[model samples]
Target: MKLRQVVPWGFTAIVAVLIGNGVLSQLTARGLTNTVNEVMQGYRVQTSLQALEQVIVDLQLGERGFIITRDPDFLRPYQTAQSNLAQEFARAKTLLQNEPAQLQNLNELEALSNEAIAVLSNNIARVRNGETPSSEELIQGNQVIEQVRVKVAQMLQAESQTLATRKDIVTRAEILSAISTLGGTLLGTLLGLSIVGFVIRQVVQPINQVTLAITSSSTEIAATVAQQEHFATEQATSVHQTNSIMEELGASSRQSAEQAQKTATGAQEVSQLAETGIQAVSYTLEDMSVLKAKVEQIAQQILHLSQQTDRIGNISELVTALANQTNMLALNAAVEAVRAGDSGRGFAIIAEEIRKLADQSKNSAAKIGVLVSDIQKAIAATAIATQEGTQTVENSLKTAEGMAQTFTGVTTAISSVALNNQQISLNAQQQAIAIQQVVSAMNSLNEGAAQTANGISQTKISTQKLNEAALDLQAVV
Candidate 1:
C-alpha cells in the first residue's frame, strides 16, 4: 500500500477506538442515574407508611382525651386525624404500587385501619351523648390502634430494606462507571499512540529513503551532463575549423576543373594540325612518283638514239669501199686507149674523164667515213650521260619515298599524342568533380556536429535543474 492510504487508515482506527470509549462511558453514566432515581422512590414509600401510622395514633389519642374529660378541643384532634387517615392510606398504596408484595400488605393495612377508625368513632359518639364509653370499648380501641402501629412498622421496615438494596446498587453502578471510563480512556490512548507509531514506520521513513535516493541519482546525472557539455563545446570548435578547411578545398577543386577544360581545348587544336600534316605528306609522295616515271621514259629514248648512230656508221663504211672500186676501174680503161693510137683518140678522151670522176667519188667517201666515226663517238658519250642521269633520278625517287614514309609515321605519332592529351583532360575534370563532392559532404558533417553540440548543452541545463529539485524533496522528506 501507498503512504497516503496506510496513514489514513491508521488514524481512522485510532479515532474509532476513542469514539467507542466515549459511547461506553455514556452508557455507564445512564445506568448510575437510573439506580439513584429508584433509591429515591424507596424513601418516598417508607415516608408514606410512617405518615399513615401517625394518623392512626393521633386519632386514638384524641379519642382518649375526649373520653376522660369530655373536652370539645379534644374532638378537634380526633376530627383532624379522621380526615387525614384515608388520604394517608391512599398515599401509602400509591407509593408502594411498583412492589407487588408491598401493595398486598398495604391493602391489609387499609382494612385494619378502617376497623380502628370505626372503634374510635364509637367512643367519640358516646362522649358527645353525655354518657361515657365502657372500659372494654376503650381497651378495644387501644388494641386496634396498636395493630395499626405494627402494620405501619412492618411496611416501614419493608420500605427501608428496599431502599438499602437500591443504595447498594447505586454504589456499585457508580464504581463500575468510574472503572470503565478509566479503562477505556487508557486503552484508547495506548491504541492511538500505537497507530501514530505505525504510520511513521510504514510511510514517513520510506519517504525519507526515497528522497535521498533521488537526490543522489540526480546529482550523478548532473555531473555526467556537465562532462558531456564540455565535449560538445570542443566538438563545435572542431566543426568550425573543419568547415574553413573544406571551403579552401572547394576553391582548389574549382581551379583544377578550369585547368582541365583548357587542356582539352588545346588537344583538339593539335589533333587538327596533325591531320593537315598527313594530307600534305601524302600529296608530296604522289607528285614524286609521277616525276620518276617521266625520267625513266627519257632514259629509254636516249638508248634508242644511240643504236641508230651505230647503223649509220656501218652504212658509211660500205659506201667508202664502193667508191674505191669505181676509181680503180676508171684508171684501167685509160691505159687501154693509149695502146690503140690514132684510131681510138675520141675513146681515150672519154676514159680520161671517167678517171677524174672516180677520183672525186673516192675523196667524198673518205670524208663521209671520218664524219661517221665522229658521230659514233658522240653517240657513245650521250649514252653514258643518259645512264648516269637515269641512276640519279632513281636514287632521288627512293629518298623521296623514304621521306614520305617518315612523314606518315610522324603524323600517326602526333595524332596519338593528341588523343592521349584529350583523355588526360577528361580524367582531370572527373577528379575535380569528385573533390567538390567531398567538400560538400564535409560541410554537411560540420553542420550536424554543431547541432549535436547544442543539444548536449540543453541536456546539461536540464540535469542541473533536476538535481536541485531532488535535493529540495530530500530535505522536505
Candidate 2:
C-alpha cells in the first residue's frame, strides 16, 4: 500500500483500538460501579436490620427506664423508636428486594420486631397507668425481645453474606477491569508499533530506496552531462580554432589564386612574346636571306666589273702603242714638209697638230691604263668583300633559323606554362572556395558545439538540483 493509505489506516486502527479500550474501560467502570452499588445496597440492608433491632431494644429500655425511674425522656426514646420501627423494616425490605432469601429473613425479622414492640408497648402502658407489671408479663416481653434479637442477627448475617458476596464481585470486577485495561493498552501499543514497523518496511523504506536510486541516477546523469558539456566546450574551442585556421587557409588560397592568376597572365604574355620573337626571328631570317642574295649578286657584279676593267686595261695598252706609232709617223711627215718649203709649211702644221693629238692620245691611254689597274684592284677588293659578305649572310641566316627554332620552342613551352599557370590559378580558386566552405561548416560546428555546451551546462545544473532534491527527500524520509 501507499504511505498515505497506510498512515491513515494505521491512524484509524489506533483510533479503533483507543475507542475499544475506552469502551472496555467504561464498561469495566460501569460494572465496578454496579457491583459497588450492590455492596452498598447490602450494607444498607444490614444497617436497616440493625436499626430494627435497635428500635426493639430501645422500646425495652424505655419501658424498663419508665418502670425503674419514671423519667419522661425514656418514654420519648420509646415513642420515637416505636414510630420509626415500621419505616426501618420497610427500608430493609426495599434494600433487600432483589434477594428473596434476604427478604424472607427481613419479613421474619419484622414479625419478631413487631411482636417485641407490642410486648414493650404493653409493659409501657402498664407503667404509665401506675400499675406494676407482673414478672410473667416482663418475662414474655423479654422472650419476644430475645426472639427479635435472634431474627435481627439472622438478617444481619444474611446481609453480611450478601455484602461479602458483592464485595467479592466488586473486587473481581476491579481486577478484571485492571487486567483488561493493561492488556488492551499493551495490545494497542504492540499493534501500533507493528503498524509503524510495517509502514516503515513497506512504505518508507521503499520510498527511501526509490529516492536513493533517483538521486544516484540524477547525480550520474549530471556528471555525464557535465562531461558532455566539457567535451562540447572543448569541441567548440577546437572547432573555433579549426575555423580560424580554415579562414587563414582560405585567405592564403585566395592569395595563391591571385598569384597564380598573375603567373598565368605572365606566362601568356611570355608565350605571346615568344611567338612575336619567333615571328620576328622568322622575318629577320627572311631579311637575312634576301640580304645574302643581294650581297651575292653584288659580289658577282663586282667580279664582272673587275673582268671589264681588265679588258679596258688591255685596250688602253693597245691604244698607247698606237698613239706612240702615230706620233713617230707624224714627226717624220713634218720633216719632209719642211724640206718642201712654204707649201710644205701648212702640211707641217697639220702634221704637228696630228702629232699633238697623237701625244694627247698617248697620255690619255697611260692615264686610262692606271685607272684600269686601280679599278681592277678595287674590283678584287669588292669580290673578296662580297665573298665574306655571302659567308656572313649565310651565318646570319643560320643564326636566324636557329633563333626562329628557339622561339618556336620557347613559344610552345610558354604556352604550356601559361596553360599550367591558368590551371593552377583555377585550382587555387577552387581550393579557396573549398576552404571557405570548410570554414563555414566549421563555424556551424562551432556554434553547434557552443549550444551543446550550454545545454550540457544547463543539464548539469538541473542534475545538481535533482540531486539536491533527492537529498532533501532523503532527509524528509
CA RMSD of each candidate after superposition: 91.9, 88.9
Q: What tens digits encode model 2's per-residue C-alpha lDDT throughout 332-437?
A: 9999989988545545655675686677668756755664564455445435534543554465455446646644764564465456546645655564454434
lDDT of 1 by residue, 1-477 (tens): 543344345434534543444454445445544554575466567657766765676677667766765767766767897899888878877777788999998998899989998998888888888888889998998898888778878887787687667656755654654565455445544644564465456534644564454345335444543453343334443443455553454344344335434433443454454345445545644654654465455446545654654565576567567756766775676677677775444445545545554564555445445544644454344344434434443543454355445435534533443353344334434433333333224445456445434533443443344334333322322
Q: Which 10-residue window of candidate 1 scores lowest in summed lDDT?
A: 468-477
Candidate 1 at residue 240, lDDT? 39
lDDT of 1: 0.55
TM-score of each: 0.50, 0.46
lDDT of 1 at 86: 81
In model 1, which regions exceed 4 Å deviation?
A: 1-6, 237-477
Q: What overall lDDT goes with each candidate model?
A: 0.55, 0.60
Model 1 clash pairs are: none
Residue 201 miss distance in model 2 (angstroms): 3.3
For model 2, give the 10-residue run with minimal summed lDDT: 468-477
